[model samples]
Target: MNESKEFLKEYDDSKYKKPSATVDMIILTAVDVETKARSVPDKVLRVLLIKRKGDPLVVDITDPYKGKWALPGGFVNYYEDLDAAAIRELREETNISDVYMEQLYTWGKVYRDLRRRVISTSYMALVDSSKLNIKAGDDAEDACWFDVKITLLEEVKTQIKAGYIRKTTYELSLVNSENEIKDTVIVTKKLEGRTSKIDLEYVNNPSGLAFDHATIIFYALERLKNKVEYTDIAFSLMPEMFTLTELKKLYEVITGKVIYSRNFRDKMEKQKKMVIETDEWESGKPYKPARLFRFNPDWVEDQ
Candidate 1:
């Protein structure tokens, strides 16, 4: 025992290399926009992105990917907790804080970062943009909310030596508040039947998003789609009070599908604890006012 204690006292952690840790944020919101084709307001999904300032070094090499758009992130402090690091990095880069956030995933692909060995733990948040003031700070050159639209371009299935592989391609379009196309990213994801796992890679990303952030955004969206069905997380992006139609539209937008009104209402009715009818209604509209409803805190407690 004394010999082992002596060996431990002389041990050095530097003998084994360690990967650097980082935290990235996916801040999402659903905003109401006026459209020429519709009398009522249309809800659009938006994501916050930051432009990199100064020169970026890629694996000890200065690369052309510098000064491109990327998610708000930074290296984690040595003494900080993972969740605290995520929230602190988000606030430092975007000037937005105190929103609903949860851990999304950890990305540790060997080549994900050209700079050193970096392992990133990402967090996802849903916020009402109107309530918070946002600005670019720290290493961020500029920050803006871009309207996000994802379209499935194609899906292919191929037989490999071991098993079957499914490949799907998606086009991600980022539009500015002025409704102009700011950037477009094409990503392809592959699912292996043998492992039942999916991996994503960039096909043609003109947006020049740093690292594997484009894939991270897509993964976060997929998780949100699944969570909205079984959880009250969707309410985080909604206004304090909204009509049933508004809520339904929000769900459809996130899921990228149109749901029948009757069926959706039926599901909502069955989950009576999820929402409560309020006496307030939308005002200053051409048609009859629609009743407003708020999310029930009781349901959250039950969950």
Candidate 2:
């Protein structure tokens, strides 16, 4: 121990250059898009984005994506943990805290950041949209929630000796009606054997999302879609109390599929035991009042 301590003291810390670490947050929510006053609302997924403040980096004289939108993120402090840095950056950029976030992925592509070498670890969080009181941080010019829609443009599959390769292309659209911001991002996913990769370019980003955020958003959306099928993660985007219809709608929106109401209710209530019934019913609807239920966190254990 004494010899190791002496070696630690004599070790040179700056012998090699290291990449700066940062954290980006993909904050998502489910929103009810209103049409006519009496029409039933349409449910859609929404993602939070911030407009860059155009501040020059210490190593650069100008910002590459100044005044454009991006995921809420910043450099990680020297003494902070990765998770802590994600939470802090989320709060600072969007005035959002008290959210449950999961580590999505780490991006370490060279030249991803123009100014300096940066490695970003992304985190994804789902929240009830009604609870947000968003404000732009010092590094951001504005904060907004854009309705998200991802559409499959094309797909192809090829058989290989070892395994099959599937390639799918998707168009991700973000629209903020109130802000009049419409952004389009195109991404492609290539699945070779057991591995898959997402690719995007600056030219593919029509609305100027900073760095490789469109790819991160695409990855997070795919994760959400897969997890919502088997896990109870979708409940994070829902309110404390919701009707069976509302729950089904939220699931359909996230998965981009049409779910039969009867089958969905049966599976959620009987097989999964994901929700518990309450005596309370929905009010002020043109149709019959629906019973409200709350999520049962112990469903997995109970099963």
Candidate 3:
């Protein structure tokens, strides 16, 4: 009986030795802006990368994204709440504040970290980059904005196809039009990239960065797709004020598809969640004055 009791004690104690994984959020934002009277949509996806001076997963950024491109993350401190830790990591890596932040995903692949089994309690933040200045801090080599490129090329992903189906009889004009049916097919021939190819390169490739952050870039892209439709997350990346067209464009970048203005706005604005600060007009653009708005945190209060 004593042996069994001791065995149970060891098993219980073993759980304590296991390192607890932490949460790291991938912050995202959609910024709507006015350009030449036409609204332009841009994503508020910033690189929260710092330099890695030590051991971890080794990756090659190639002739692109080199030097300064990695994720904004850190070891979760004991006693720090996961949400608080994610926000702290964001602030520590990027010298910016007062933006929208939320949990994105938990990246816990055993090989995600080379030095240890770091199960990140990841979070995502959206900010108006045009409104604040960012810099490298802590382990970050540097920080900057890189345009995201989401590829929908035919060669890359499976094409969704639709067509009418019909059969012909042996006799002329005996085609089976009466039995016509439409068919849609997804050619799962080639494997889809683990994540869609969302590419981000340095606005200026001078600063040296670290890691497989492009993967994080892709992860952010995917997160935005689902987030914009449901949450007020898109506005986190937009300016304090914006126009409808610009809002639509922001939706496009997040969804990887073009959204019709009227229908898109009908759905987008109705979310009744995120709103903009209106009565604001053109900044420096020469066009019809468009209204602008900022993200409303109230829509997300207690949410």
Tens-place lDDT per residue, model 3, 101-172, is 666656655655445556776666666556666776776665554444444322333343432222211100
The superposed Cα distance between candidate 2 and the true structure at residue 40, in angstroms, equals: 3.7
How does residue 54 of candidate 3 score in lDDT? 34
Per-residue lDDT tens digits of candidate 1, residues 258-290?
988778776665544677888898998765678
Q: What is the TM-score of each candidate against the true structure?
A: 0.88, 0.87, 0.60
Q: How far does residue 270 in candidate 1 sit from its true spot (Å)? A: 2.6
TM-score ranking of the models: 1, 2, 3
Q: Distance from true position, residue 55, model 2, in Å?
A: 9.4
Clashes of each: 1, 0, 35
Q: Higher lDDT: candidate 2 or 3? A: 2
Q: Report the lDDT tens digits of candidate 2 across residue range 1-303.
A: 999999999999899898899999999988887866754576889899999876434333356777778899999999999999988888888899888899999999898888789999999989887878999986889999998877777778777665665666667777886644333445545566678776654334535477888778888998999998888998888888999888898988988899998999998999899999999998898767889999997888446
Question: Best lDDT goes to which candidate?
Answer: 2
Model 3, position 214, has a per-residue lDDT of: 40
Q: Residue 194 error for model 3, in Å?
A: 22
